[model samples]
Target: MSTTDTSNSPITNRRRGTLQLWSRTLIPTLREAPAEASTPSHRLMLRAGCIRQVGAGVYDFLPLGMRVLQKVSQIVREEMDAAGASEMLMPAIVPIELYAGTKRDVDYGDLLFKLTDRHGRDAALGPTHEETVTEMAKGSVTSYKQLPLNVYQIQTKFRDEFRPRAGLLRGREFLMKDAYSFHTTVEGDGGLNETYDRMYQAYVNVFTRCGLDFTVVEAEAGPIGGSASHEFMVNAETGEDTILVCPETGYAANVEKCEIGDRDWSFDTDATTDLTKKHTPGMPGIDLVAEHLGVKPEGMLKTIVFAKIGGDKRKYVLATVRGDHDVNEGKVRDVVGFPIALADEKEAKEAGFAIGYVSPRMAATRDDTLLVIDPDATGGVWATGSDEKDHHVTGFIWARDLGADLPTKDQQGGKIRVADVRNAGEGDPSPRLPGAKLVARRGIEVGHIFKLGTKYAQAFDFTVLNEQQKKTTVIMGCYGIGVSRTIAASIEQRHDEWGIIWPVPIAPYHVVITVMDPKNDEQSKLADKLATELVEAGADVLIDDRNERPGVKFKDADLIGLPVRLTIGDKALAENCVEFKLRSEDGKGRLVDIADAVKETLSKLA
Candidate 1:
């Protein structure tokens, strides 16, 4: 079947047999979610008996959960195959040497699960396979003719999460579909971008078919360093990640990577004021200092001292921003081209800087220090540190007080650097369209695609001979969908107060036949016949054939949240019909003729 096929046709049915509830399996429905359940997805997953906790951040999928997971995986496989990607398997327990090639062992930090083998060799569970796949391509593929290959696997990955909460949303062990592409050159039609585009469309198809309401936003590559990347986020109010969106321009990005439009840094007033220092003892924070000076926070300049990490020389960096704004460390790292930490009191003191009373004027004196000034603080007259303990400077204008030599770019000695080092706030101008402002929303990241460039291939020495007979490194791209987390995210997006209202595509069963009383021969026969017909007509039918009370069966049916519910009761049978209800809708369903039940159910499924 084609990947784009949307109909619930028989050709797409993977499981042919019918499921009988109360006899064949277990669904331990609960009245209340466990106290630890924080999000809607976590609560619904447990109360519906879809999953059970094995440990902190570990979970065991029950039969119903397994079925849904399999269905989701099948959809992913179909879309990936349709995108011309080959499926393969890799060992989850990867050797530490693979990561050593990329130095990800240190980069991943405590999140990597490491172990010592019996042979005294180091091993670690794979959080991702960029290194492994790059190494494999390095050893196996060696010619341009064998380039432009994409390989993927649906497998479980492990990360030693410190706080794994929200059930499957942030589990230590979870299933993921990760695909890596290799190419000879990044230039033409048959290059990394071509495959990246195809994978992007494939992700769209998978999420659309799975009936998720999601947004594709530009994202930072985090630990998976890459040139360009995007995240597929399922929109929800309770989601952890913040996304900035511009509805007017249809531009969206994760907050970490979001860029804001230029701000009007021109002086609000041309009035000049001389820099004056005054003693204010023991003012601990910006709010307190602002109050001490009888000024608003926005009228103050915040100076922070940072020390460069992972460098041979210990260098102190000064970062300045508007007092109301917080410095985005990621942006600072991008500017400094190295990791940085807040300089300790002793380090700042030794560097000839006051720990809390440093000012932009110090940049003029300390030419060796790297100074990063936020755009908002460029030309404003503001209150700031006075380079003396227990003292602050008021009416400090950048042009007048900080000297004429200011760095417009990075790493220019003896000059103050100007850049956007502050976090983009809610009302900031949008980066894309003129006059548009950015709005913030919450989202759960279910999928991500990265344009990896040659970071991995270079590290692993993955190269191929080109048509010109010269050696060229392979450009790579990595795409991943959190298969299990997608399930939780869907629930987070789609569930109601009662239970999970599963989308038709990934729900364990499409139609649930509730026989009011199994002992009633007529009702029993009718339900069995309907199940068989529904199964043949490309619907997963679950028969609630338990010898339970009518109220019990109906409640369980509602809690299970099958798309369509067929209740075979004595009253409905006397009327020569059965009731058909859609779980998403309210009220009792209208009666349909017994002979027409199959056709009506099929119509609803369509």
Candidate 2:
């Protein structure tokens, strides 16, 4: 069997650019995924030989993975260009000083991969280029005419994740497409708002083209300090984040930012009883205390103490929620109107708090302490800490025990502040629609867009001249898309027991030509002819011409998951036809005339 040695031929090289032969490729598919590959996408990527882990939270993209990445990146590039964002590159090593000026260095904390340069100066790998890009604008963009300029880069980012799991979904080192836009105003034409909308649409187009079932939800701009933000989440069963959606009004938000509607939070006057101390030895958690008292968690108050981040150490806020509900620290921060951290047990103890047995009434023991209770926690007869070791207060009623401290209505100005400072959950009423409850869905966030306002502009001194010839700080916006994570997310959303069913647009190759007998001249000639035709028809073709059995070739084709597959065998060709299959479809596929191979493949791809 003399196969043509065209590995270096000019025509072969040209075809190799988009048409790959299985014999010349480097796919090392594993029969079984490793135990450490926890997620479906992680397991499949490993078994399909798309990536190999090099270190914790880091992986090397194999050839197949690189092709998928290139295709996804190209889609991003085209959409960004169409949205008027100019592509630019920034250095990966950023000086620590840039972040120090914005105080984000402290915000990033250990997440920044800090290093000492040769000159003894501090530097770090760029996690995001907001500071660098803002500094650049401060130096060059000083005129109103240069306003509303958006520049972006497709680059690698590093974050020191405490635990990077789920493959590329949450990696310490990964590829990202981050874009920054500078504007003179916020809402007018060619301003930050306009540019933000354009970028949002571009993201929609990009993800849509990549074939993701996603939802755009209101989100909190954590650490980035933006006024407004939204996250594009790809729906997945094994996603890390919980998304709450309102079926009636189409309002959706991540659990961290979702709001709860009005509930019947009136105090249960009939259930009120004298607050009496009861023994609850060794019961530190709400669940433990509730279990000890033979009461439901919903009828208990869970008080958590927090100290202001930059305020007096002795001063604390007692954040209380229903035992069944969890306090949202973000909502607590907003109610407190400052940054706060969970109070250290030692410091809390020193401040007259019982620590484990601390209760809402602990606010009365210290002049500096404030009580903030979630509305749901303010109504029911509750079991709470007794301000002493190994004791709890049973029959705790808000109106009777707390008295004047408990607000008459849900407001912040009272002695006992009441607010919706708890995380929303499934069946919780939607804040936007009356009588409609919030639904839950798991999602993987793929893109985020933020209206940054002037947070970075002010920090970096980025300003521009207004029409009045006066200097004004530029309004800025930040947008990010997880370039590599999208691949894993796509697999998470589209994979089956057989293998990944890659989307047509982002598949490593659009079609795989499986030759049942590569050594046979008839089968080999048919594969070459069909591959050339498909390549000319603008489809990436991978010819399975390796000396493998028919079953092996078919399995490999399904495992790699090209969008379309064409099988050429002596039996099929003897009937002047070939097997046409779609990887996304079930069954072995129907026979088609050999002459119609290219046309049918292109139709399936389209």
Query: Which candidate tops lDDT?
Result: 2
- TM-score versus the correct structure, for each prediction: 0.90, 0.94
Off by over 4 Å in 1: 1-18, 221-227, 267-295, 307-316, 333-349, 378-381, 387-395, 403-414
| lDDT for each residue of candidate 2 in 84-168, tens digit (9 for 90 to 100) | 9999999999999999999989999999999997889999999999999999878888799987799999999999998899999
Query: Model 1, 150-179: lDDT tens per residue?
Result: 999999999999899999999999999999
Say which candidate scores most in TM-score. 2
Worst 10 residues of 2 by lDDT: 8-17
- Cα deviation of 263, candidate 2, in Å: 1.5
Clashing residue pairs in candidate 1 are none
